[model samples]
Target: MARDGLAAHYQGEDIAERILSALRAAQGADARVTAEVLAPLDHFHGRGLAATTEMAARLDPQADDRILDIGSGIGGPARWLAERFGCHVTGLDLMPSFCRAAEALNAAVGLSARVRILQGSALDLPFPAASFDHAYSQNVLMNIADKARFFTEAFRVLKPGGLFAVSCVGAGPGGEPFYPVPWASTPAESFLATPEETRRLVLDAGFDLVRFEDRTEAMLPARRRMLEEVERDGLPALGWHVFMGAERSLELVANTVRSDLAGRLTTLELLARRPG
Candidate 1:
């Protein structure tokens, strides 16, 4: 799919307003809007806030650091990291709607001073070389066909000795994943690399691999439960479905879980550092 097509796939109308309204309905009209409160709704990837939390732990960002959130969807992790670590975070994504919503949410939570949102592509980041202290991307690689350029751009932007953490779905031994998954509606938009290929690309991009894990086996049980819950009771009121639409979101989640169970998909996590 072309860049415009991919952006169109993820775009939503009045995203920030809808998200805020949902939160109000769930937690009273006057409840405070904190990152924790918005966790269930804004983190637009697999496993939601839990995945972001794990990536943060691996990055181990410091209070004074300047972090870059590649493919930041609605700034959930960016706001969370800025609030929790007292760090400045710049979130970049391709979808204009996501960027606008992220900015609005940042202002809503009083993190506008700490979190910044930009609209851009992962293959071509909009920053200068050695611009950030650390960076991370969650579930962003599947949409990017040029994996090498994605990793290379990330490597180029980080300061020497900076960390780059990534969590994404990789191709498993059983072949292609089921269609209409969260990242893409069809195979044309999804470009998954195997675990071995992903490792090589990171290394070839000049990152010293600190940790790499194929977490599929360990995460399958929880994934199954999530699918079951969605099947039985439908999507929760405060979930990704708020923006993705209930029926489409349900189909996406179901396909993702079914693909995983069939060994056609694998979850991957990597922590790498730039050699000084």
Candidate 2:
């Protein structure tokens, strides 16, 4: 496969070599995390069946739906959702490399009929108002510094009564800021909020809060599982291949995991509805 331009830009020459090296490491990292079926290194398909299953159920997509995925990194979750739910998807990400790679993957998987990848930011989507039946983002918010603008944009693009669902890393105890996500290097401008603050932002954005909950417990185990895999196999098993090839990336991931464990970062799921 020719290197996707955006990936080549970020990953540089020898994307395949780098990816394969990471995958090999992940394969040995953890029997549980790496077990051929659940690896995060395969793409960015982190956490595995449970996360995807939960997402699919929460999305409840339909053939009539036109869904938008914000901050889609190479369209992993978007691809999974389209195939599983049979809905059309428009994947938005700032990185051209990710968009190109995602498009290629969609074509390879014969999902081009249902998926489109676009390059853009969540704060300024190219679509018109109320254009989509639903919108979703996963692990994407922490990289952004503007929750108000983010939620407002999500609101702007969703049709009346449409749903907005998100899974993201949030603040730890006392609502401390969690920072330095893959998209950013500092939490100084990275915005995070508690469950309550999140709700406020959504309501202010003109959406009705449907449900919100801390899902950290379910995912926190993944960190332990990740490190365990590393200890036992020397790398992770699935979906996080990019993190394994370079020592710097590995250190970044390790620090990230450490942050998660220290309760400096937490994760959650939130659902809101555009009122009719």
User: How far in Å is the alpha carbon of 119 misplaced in model 1?
Assistant: 0.9
Worst 10 residues of 2 by lDDT: 30-39
Candidate closest to the true structure, highest lDDT: 1
121-202 in candidate 2: lDDT tens per residue? 8989899999999998887776666889999999999999889888777777744433334434454435667767777888
Candidate 2 vs. true structure, TM-score: 0.79
What C-alpha lDDT values do all the predictions have?
A: 0.91, 0.68
Worst-scoring 10-residue span by lDDT in model 1: 1-10
TM-score of each: 0.98, 0.79
Which regions of candidate 1 are displaced past 4 Å?
none
Model 1 TM-score (2 dp): 0.98
True lDDT of residue 239, candidate 2: 41
